[model samples]
Target: MAYKKETMESDCIKAILDNNLMFQEDIFSFVGFARSTYFDRSLDKSDAIKKALNDNRIKTKHTLKKKWEKSDNPTLQIALYKLICDDHEFNRLAGVKNDITSGGEPFDIEVFIVNGKNKTKKKD
Candidate 1:
């Protein structure tokens, strides 16, 4: 009763999307697989997801289509920015703006992801 790669991946994706937005490792565990296989499969999936995200960013920034819009509230805008900036691509592009030192301004966090995608701020 072995599952195929497509079945494994689809189950992994569903477990991820179905849960409370767990990490890659968490997703792998959910599907009862080892870390190695998860990492091997994740590399390609991560790349594809990131490429799609980049495309969305381009569309959001360059067109009047306005597929996505930030809230007008400074508080909400900053929160949304922090959420988007959590992505590695966004963090690097923004100089890791989300990282807070001991003596920096404080802000509220809304959504969080885990693993390399962890979005929670570490208390320094």
Candidate 2:
């Protein structure tokens, strides 16, 4: 049995919004549509489906940001930081020592590098 385009599109949109899915496979799986059929019908190329996924992703990010801001949980804070902070900031806050020297001895190097930047390392 073949499904109507409208039915398939609506089902895919609902699956995306409801499941907060951002990937094509997850959306098609949740909606019980075959990946090949989805691609063949160009349902994967639908602008509506793309917009729904992007919008839902933005909404989820905003929700998570708000929750992270108000909560004092260290895990949540770290998770959000990992999501938003650059590699340098994350390493600094997490106490990740990216020491390139093989031994414990401090060598006289002209430039100190952290996350690809050559400057004085900030005290965490």
Candidate 3:
């Protein structure tokens, strides 16, 4: 299919000019540009248009985050938290230490079986 120019929002144009890492998918979706068209345009489109598509991605993310936070559903907030939080790396980044001391003294760690089941038993 032939590439066709699509009308993009004025804000989107400004977004591209302001940000260097705008999400192309958001720009394409917002401007009704096909993926193929986007790639093709990337090769020949004016530098200004290219920059706008790249920079608009941040605006897209900001918009989504606002919606996620505003939603009344609990899961939406959790989803927003996941989107913003780096919990997986929090422990290392926060300088957390992994040391376990029992009653400030050495303790015996034992394993036992009961009813054909095994479980850990800690003793002081």
Candidate 4:
């Protein structure tokens, strides 16, 4: 039997959106298609399926961003900061330890925790 695009397209879209599937192989597997069929049918090139997958992924990202924004979790806030902030700002906020010296010697370290303020400690 051959795979029918007309019959499988809707199922593919539904599975993608329902499962929040982001990978082509996962989507094809969820829809019960062989890997060879996926390539032979050019399912990767199908605009409808591609659009559905991209849209679903973007929608999922937006939902997660919203949740992260609305919550008061500092970990998530720091994670979001890491995504948007420059290396300097992120290091300032999350703290960075330079544990190796230019001379290849162990260096003192300062660890910062996001518990409302920054704290520092020296490595023993």
Candidate 5:
């Protein structure tokens, strides 16, 4: 007996949706199917069955925002500035300066540098 492409796709989608697997590769492995087979039959459809299955998947918006906030660490930012000013040496010639302010302020930092004989103010 042979199953229609749509039926196979729905079955695959059911397996994928019910399983604990989060990644495409993991789902494919769990079902003992090839990537090509899984994607072509399911993920490749216009009304992609895989998309419907994973529709309720939680997004990592909070995690990413937290990481971004960490990356914007004031200490790290200042350290980078100091490193640039000390190591680059040319920053002085380029007239690069670090001016930072904090707390609900309009801007966190203001950088004044001479660019082609004109003073440029950069806000971060």
Candidate 6:
């Protein structure tokens, strides 16, 4: 069957957009479509689903932004800020990459033959 945009928007797509936590699987289950349909000959329908999902995400973000703007609660404000912004200090820390090199400090790792057998020694 061909992709029915109106029916999907009125039903499954509507439900998916209404729930922020609904994943692709949830949408497929709600729409009574198999997950495999997206990979087979129904790829176009899958693309439509993705576009609708993106639209819903934008709508959801806008709604959240409006609600966050109207609130006077400091904790709520912090939560929203944390959701949208990253800590500068943490970002700097995350960007620091530790390169493994033999240039920092000198250490003696040598094996010396003592008597007849080999012995490991460390420089003091």
Which candidate has the highest TM-score of all?
A: 4
Poorly placed runs, candidate 2 (over 4 Å): 3-7, 86-88, 94-124
Give the per-residue lDDT digits (tens) of candidate 1, residues 7-124: 6666665665556333454555567766676666554366533454455556545452232344456655554565565467566656755666446666666975555665689999
Clashes of 3: 3
lDDT of each: 0.55, 0.84, 0.59, 0.79, 0.56, 0.62
Deviating ranges (above 4 Å) for candidate 4:
86-124
TM-scores, all candidates, are 0.33, 0.58, 0.36, 0.62, 0.35, 0.46
User: Which structure is stronger by TM-score: 1 or 6?
Assistant: 6
Q: Which model scores highest in lDDT? A: 2
Q: Comparing 3 and 6 by lDDT, which wins?
A: 6
- A best-first ranking of the candidates according to their TM-score comes to 4, 2, 6, 3, 5, 1
Least accurate stretch of 10 residues (summed lDDT) in model 6?
37-46
Model 2 lDDT per residue over 1-124, tens place: 6978888999999998888898777876687768787887889889999999889888988998999978899989888888889878978988886876669677777965567855588799
Where in model 6 is the C-alpha error above 4 Å?
Answer: 1-22, 42-45, 83-124
Q: Evaluate model 2: give its lDDT.
A: 0.84
User: What is candidate 3's lDDT per residue for 1-124, written digit by digit as tens?
Assistant: 5544443334347545555435555554444456666666553355666666544666777888899899998888877776666755554544684546677677778976667854667787
Q: Candidate 5 versus the native: TM-score?
A: 0.35
Q: Model 4: per-residue lDDT, tens digit, 17-58?
A: 889888787886687777787777777798988998888788
Pairs clashing in candidate 5?
A: none
Model with the higher lDDT, candidate 1 or 6:
6
Off by over 4 Å in 1: 1-3, 42-124
Indicate the worst ten consecutive residues by lDDT in candidate 1.
Answer: 62-71
